[model samples]
Target: MLAKAIFLDIGGIVLEINWRKTVEALGVFDRSQQDQIWSVLGSAKIHLELERGNATPQEFFAFVRSELKLSPEAPLEEAWNQLILGPLPQVDQIFDRYAGRVPLYALSNTNRPHYDYFMKQFPVMKRFDRILTSFELGHRKPDSEIYMAAATEVGLSPSEIVFIDDSPANVDAAGRLGFRSFHSVNSVSATLEILQRHFSN
Candidate 1:
């Protein structure tokens, strides 16, 4: 079916990220502590609060410093943002091809700091018709509310919107909600391939 709108995930799909970069930047020298650092950084309980806007970046950074036992003056913000390396290769092609063809929305599960950093650093981000973020929406992906909210914002039914995300769980959630969902597996080429099959005339 032809899509009236498309919702795309930012990190991992439109942009490349490396969590280990953040961990190393934070000075976690022990290999044994890397997994622990990953768990702490990725912990849904801790990170989700930031994504949902329930916790301020300062609060989150303080918690990370305490949890990870980093120096009090650790460059937490810079280190945390190390996860966002840069945009995916050829991502602008997707926007170039589809910007005016159909509505393109960025649906991202992100916090305020990351949002601010990417917005300024990535010019491609300006290409989106709209950006729906977890921090702004108070909801994250794999949750039905955010998807429903996206549909409401665009005034489209789930079936009429094509959703693209790297996470299988998020794709499954969107699919369950009746969206025409595609798992792009963090590849711009894969995303372009999927969009061409559906969005190309």
Candidate 2:
């Protein structure tokens, strides 16, 4: 049985960020342009900069405008906000049930602006026992260092913990490092089941 900790991935696991839905709602750009925009936005450099708190929404907007050759009329911030379209209401309840009963953590490969935006928008989001962001860590998922750091910070053997993430690569990485891991599809229901089974010990 897993004895020590539980870690969650914030993006799709706790909060749903549907970039495609958001861009469509923004209505200024078509699917093709949105795809291009995501290509640039999801680049390692840009994402790392965001995680480090080195970039602001306005700054990202400016960068996108310049790169896409678009005019200043785009609603970048608003469109970005659209990504967090639906907040998972049951998220806190799950944490509440298990936080002190077992160690709980949040690990994400998110940039600064989105991190700030999430905190400001969702007070309940900050309830994790430990919060690890890639930008802040200077290391993102699928990298062993970040996982090592998380386990170290929590003071547990990697074998005693389980890591949950929306990415297969991340799940596999954690698995290789001896963490029990789950790919966070159908997150709340599936995760709660895993936690219940593990923590029942």
CA lDDT scores, all candidates in order? 0.88, 0.77
Summarize candidate 2's per-residue lDDT along 1-201 as a digit string, tens digits: 546888889887889888786567556467788897677767736555666556655676777668666668876666666787555757776777886788778988877667778888887677777788887776788889888887887888788988888899999999999999888763687778877877863
- Cand. 1 Cα-lDDT: 0.88
User: Ten residues in a row with the worst lDDT in model 1?
Assistant: 37-46
Error of 2 at 148 (Å): 1.0
Cα RMSD (Å) per model? 1.3, 2.5
Give one digit per residue, the lDDT tens place, for model 1 in 1-201.
Answer: 457888999988899988888888977767778887787679748689899999999888888888777788888999888889988888998998999989999999999999999999999999999999998888999899999988998899999998999899999999999999989866888898888877774
Where is model 2 more than 4 Å wrong at Cα? Answer: 52-59
- Backbone clash total for model 2 is 4
TM-score of each: 0.95, 0.85
